[model samples]
Target chain A: MTREPDSHYSSGNEAVIGWDIGGANLKAVRLSREGLQVVQQPFAVWQRRDELAEALARIAAELGPAPCAAVTITAELSDAFRTKRDGITFILDALQSALPETELKIFGLDGKFHHPAKAYQQPMLVAAANWLATALLVARDLADCLLVDIGSTTTDITPIGGGKVLAEGRNDPERLVRGELLYTGASRTPICALVQRVPLWGGWCPVAAELFATTQDAHLLLGHLPAEQCASPSADGRPATPEYALERLARVVCADTELLSQAEVQAIAQYIANEQIHQIAGAMTQVLSRVKVVGPVAAVGAGAFLAEAAAARLGLDYLRPATLARGAASVAAPAVAVALLLNEEACV
Target chain B: MTREPDSHYSSGNEAVIGWDIGGANLKAVRLSREGLQVVQQPFAVWQRRDELAEALARIAAELGPAPCAAVTITAELSDAFRTKRDGITFILDALQSALPETELKIFGLDGKFHHPAKAYQQPMLVAAANWLATALLVARDLADCLLVDIGSTTTDITPIGGGKVLAEGRNDPERLVRGELLYTGASRTPICALVQRVPLWGGWCPVAAELFATTQDAHLLLGHLPAEQCASPSADGRPATPEYALERLARVVCADTELLSQAEVQAIAQYIANEQIHQIAGAMTQVLSRVKVVGPVAAVGAGAFLAEAAAARLGLDYLRPATLARGAASVAAPAVAVALLLNEEACV
Candidate 1:
């Protein structure tokens, strides 16, 4: 694993924070003379978008204050807003209102931070740029590598070569076509989205196309994720424990624990987890085939373990998120990347 | 079209009602001296299972009380209950409370009706027996055929041969394996469940796994269903119109109308509609390969048109629901079947 260089936050410049405001999560990282401080919160933007400003205010209060903050966002893709332009404007408005004293810089697809006004005029350039932020940060260190950042709901397989981000798709739609974005993730993806049928009771049982269970349940049951780290809400609105997850997972095949033994449910979980890994691996292979100078895969985020599994399946070496960010900040790599990038600018 | 025999409701017997209680719909039909009275209501059982008793009572009040009510239910498959037994018990309790003076007979997989106690003891027998109720009714007329009943959220493909319900699988799980129960429906199924990617902007773009849109939007936009018939809630909580449907369809690819033209959105809807038909057709082929004496395909329910399309695609003769029931009764075939079957038993 390649370790990141020391903090670029010089003592002479005031500390600047970074925020990656996603549809389902809010990640904030503050870089100062002391060290890196991270705050991660789960906020359902699509359901409770009206509460975003208040949530942002609460995060701002917890992180104290900074003179400026750099922001990369995927929240613009949330269905709460009619269009990304509207989402970008709403988020920028909320950011300004929540952090009235701090200046805000919006990270764009071009790997540059622009003033809020410029972002408003060219919202598409800044929409869903969180992946770019992490990729740009990884590009700074690795001359050639693939950054496989798997979040709660989506995976970003960004390729970096020659110390530059070489992503062919600039937008989500294009990225999806190029296999750079695989919608299935470790937590939020519905089990039915991964596979239509699961091997059960000596037969392949078709799964219910409902949100009966998510990858969180499968991962939680299979020990890929702990109870605490199962951040997404249970599909059945039950507790996030393995017992409840097993019930939810059983329902994916329209059965309950009463009908299915624990061993059977565990097998189902294992199958789902394996299929999820295979899905990521398939996408990674498609991505790797296109990029020149294939390097080690940098697995990062809440689903970094899934990325590593995918990397292993492809017989490729993998790097942990700690190679780029430390501790919880590694899971919040985009937030840390923006903070570090902003800090470097301040020093320059 | 093979027409069904005249109603066997001998005026001597007291009026009988039949209820097909589904997870998303409550379809009630009354067979009295004055012909058939059908009532269909949308009730989200998974979200509000506790209100089921009240809903049943309200429907009873609307249809008026009967001496006896024969019921077939698919609501037991809802995740609201821990097990099918629990669901059956709860539904029976609701029925008893809703009609204290009425005699209740539960439809079973044995092509017979049993007392509520029998259903409670062997809930699996009556868990999803609505399909059987319809099949038995069709079996009375057609000696050999496939009963393709496509509701809002699921499609049941039951084969009947030699005037018997020759279904390979009894319950939902088993039926799924035998290609007798397809989870895809006409309206409520999430679009992502149908296909992982859609042809968009000269490329195949991955669809968002989120419930941003459903089959209702595709069928609505494609004119397969009228706006008033879109009983399911819109995925974006927008109006059930082609305009808003286009918006929702675009979001499946993480784009909006701003990025996608109406023609493009319509193309996407067309693709989804065609794929849904292909899915049913594929299942129909798998099912047909197993059964002997393959006969006409009787298309019924809200998605009878879809079933008809599937039948045509397989180059098989198709019969409309009207072949067995009339008017709206065709859409509420299960309810109508239970009513006719119970009425016949009453006459005997």
Candidate 2:
């Protein structure tokens, strides 16, 4: 769906657009003097990476033309391509093909933008830098805060202090080890990956190793996510309804509705949700202990509620990205952040 | 490929065919006065469960019909069906349709064969009982021993003592929690699931959560599995060759062949193989500590070499399933075991 920016952020500066291309979704934000406009689409790049240029062309057309475009990418980590270099080069080529006239600047982990040629030369710099873009925008408002941006497939826990991004890791692999990046998220994570054993029948019941269900089922059953937010496909190829969700969850324990009562299935769902929170909180605790950032946690992305809950568990104050980028832009924080950064630089 | 049993175990009784229907493959063994014969085919029941009857029919024609048919199944645990009951009922129906004239008996955890109608009533008893079938066969030869069966997708560690099966858990869920069932195997398991971080560049680099490479690639590259033994499809659908396996393994760390030397990629393979052995040994330690069995480890299945290594690490002597069932029948131990059991019962 297309989300037009509010008229308040409109200034008499040249229009710019930002793109946060991820493995599962494509998010774009247009910041013009008329206001900020945001558009996000669920694109399974791994399956249809060949058509990425067409998908981008459609979104670019809807968002209209701009003189310059700012881009940050985590799609390079998708298994669709062999390496980050292949993914980065393919995405940059798609962007160029889709928006041939625009001056494209690739966002890097150093919190700066580079030419597409430079991005191709050193792809790791542009690989998975979407978190840094959002952190840069958050740092402008709050000098010392933990930025927790949880998207559909991953979570980024970056520490911001002294109006600078205090991230110990510069890339995804390093970030994962340092507890600055968590593979768990709101919707796309396989439920089996989150918990090896779930509570059932007053005992610990191990789950099937297969991808029988996903976190989308857990969050949907628990009402943590609205129906529209479950953009990913269900594990069973069924609709994202509560009944099918319960059916999918039942398979996790090698049981079915005939064996497990609705209440029993709902309890499993609750356990799964609780386990997700527990894991996210554990990672946050690790990061907080290491970074020693004593400030409110600014939660962003579509899974901001999960981040906020994680923050509460650690007895830390919580802030919203809306304090900086209001409305739908908050959910598409990385895209909006890059647009704003490029806009400010253009104005200068 | 169809594997005919050698003429060594021929006896004067009505022939009985045993079947072990797993999620990833179908195995069948026939025992008669003429001899014993074994045939295993890679049939992804999860993807084409409807064609199970057809696949069984083709195999049955090759092995010839028997007076009675015995069956033990783990295919019902596949996500292709909603629950174990569904998987059990579907597989039973396939067997009935494929061998309409043969008397069909379902093998259960109790080490006995029940009528198909009775099996439907007690589905869990018949679900995932293949390991039990093999254990019963082992108990006849070695009264006190640990049964380690490592297949394409899972490993089962069942302890037998006093010529009796002493299993603490009968079902997959319980077995998983008790350390008797390890979801990791020599092949089919995603490398990311075996270890979250792999040793790379003299440091631990976290792997991408996607199914970029599987244990099949690691085993195939390290020569643990011959190309012919890799019956399952590769992660990238590439041919089961060392060169392609290396390419797939490189992607485990978000690198490519150009970025990593062949030696570096081989090191990752060695690490994955070691971690798998370490995990199996850890589980064996848990089982031994609880059950207090001082016997040797009887390793079987397509991944028997892996089980042998794990057994050695725990300071236990190793035995082969061939001690009980000779030739190709050892690799298809459960199938051969059930066929022999049914043949003995029918003769009486």
Candidate 3:
């Protein structure tokens, strides 16, 4: 989800912890009714389930005793053989065990927040939580619109019609190969799959099979993707560097590049940048075709490079959660949007 | 390269051999000038390039010696790599040795044929051979056209502008990753990468990570992809089905279904078909954005299933090469178009 500005809440100063479980990172935002505060910590979902729970507990502890907590889990946490329901159950159980006293609202697809008792009635609660949050934030204006939320591992293109998230297809990897899931993402996407040729100064080049570069490296070089986002390690928890990106991307194919110069690697980076632009543009076009979205296109996630490029290509106004959620540095725009929606609903 | 009718060459007796050397298959076609008598063959391009050569030789013996050979070497034989060039050279040398006194010309991108004296310029030669055949058939009419050749492993979207092939990127796998080469193809492409979800009767499903289905299976079931074009085991050294096309396609994905019910397999096939359509649509849109072509799209290669689907979706005219080649059953329309173009240039 895209980063958003922190807004002050003045109602009850009781702290509420918001958790954004992503494929690669577990981002948490602790807020009280008074204002937003920073909880400086890093959480990796790639850790063991129990270890991850402990990390979440530590974050919760930092927030002190919170009266309520809203948690959303997202990631490639399960193997191919496992079902989403099973995966969701495992994560929810872990969250409950770690933070017992606080009232827990697990998100699901029914467009309602429910406790463990009602979990069986609805599926995709974790996925729906984020969508619900997104929906709640923009409900007034987005009666009939397409919500394109690009994250590190996958892009969620949900068509929102009549203030609800229009269900398209499953938003996971297996479904990814089926058309509903687009595999390209911001952080950890394989670069080899993006482009087929690299353009050199003189002419185009066929990239050698070696881990040459990635979309991150290309965006970093192109200045389209920010270094801050690139600062984070890959989904696999590998550090990001030009050398590492190149090394991983080169592995997409087999090439003898041990003796090759750095210039060749740079050329591959340029090619990847161009291809990323192309793919982002294509995906944006697909989203546009499915829904009749006009004017402003809400861009979210760490993939600002793609968002900016898509904005230019589609000739639409772009809204980034990062810009809107400026002061509230702790809460991402998607999380904030969700919180705001839930708050509004709580009052009603 | 969509198929065009055989109006250029009327000579009924003379036959020409067309060979497509790929990473997985050696596809060859022998056709009469009038396109009447035709013989098509395929050989598995597994390990052991020497065995591949022997397999081709056997096919040649079955088809008998032709007046001339028009060869288009893709993948490892496209002279893109040192090993590929050496392999092609070995195969051509063997062909010459097996059938003496016949003129053997290796195709290149220079739009010209070369003898052994100029064999060092193999890369340019292969491109020229492909272009020579392609250029001659269409000539002035080829401008502003995108030649989409979808084989087993990858697809080539070459733009023809100003009566010349637009040389933008390398026609190999490494360069292909750079976006200059689109990896999605008709046969043998991994299904896991197609789509992430499949819509079932109840809800959208995330495909399991096990050997399930492939694009080949989808196309075959849809009846848009012809079974005759599929590779199979044959006594006469021609392309024959390995067994059931469905079984081969099932091997492309990792879905546990050794004893899967027919309904289950069909569901997987449906998902694959959906993914193929999405990919083809996306790729076609990319080509349309890059170039402006006025004429009908010429769809060629084994993956015509995608091309046809793309054409239908885009509301564009679809030209099938086989329909144009008429009597030339062996040489697909796109290949025939290339061959006719080469023949015309030879006469000129």
Off by over 4 Å in 3: A1-13, A37-47, A125-129, A141-146, A158-181, A196-214, A235-238, A250-263, A321-324, A327-331, A345-348, B1-348
Q: For residues A128-201, could you state the per-residue lDDT of candidate 1 as single tens digits?
A: 98899898888877878888999899999998898888889988988998999999888999988888889998
Predicted candidate 1: interface RMSD?
A: 1.3
Q: For each model, chain A TM-score?
A: 0.95, 0.96, 0.78
Report per-candidate DockQ.
0.64, 0.36, 0.04
Q: Give per-model TM-scores.
A: 0.94, 0.89, 0.50
- Candidate RMSDs in order: 3.6, 3.3, 12.7
lDDT of each: 0.85, 0.83, 0.51
Task: Give the winner by TM-score: 2 or 3.
Answer: 2
Give the alpha carbon lDDT tens digit for every residue of B131-204 in model 3.
23543444355555555656565655555676666534443443343343566667555454455455554455
**DockQ for candidate 3:** 0.04
lDDT of 2 at B226: 88
Best by TM-score: 1
* Model 1, C-alpha of B23: deviation from truth (Å): 1.5
Q: What is candidate 1's lDDT per residue for B1-348, written digit by digit as tens?
A: 112323533224678888999988898877777667778888989899989999899888888768889999988777787777888899999999988988898898888898888888888888888888898888878888889988899999989898888888887777888899999888889988788889987878888989899999999998999998887888878889988898889889988888888999999999999999999999998888898646899888889999999999989998874445465677788888888788778523
Q: Candidate 2 chain B, which ten residues in sequence have the lowest lDDT sum?
A: B321-330
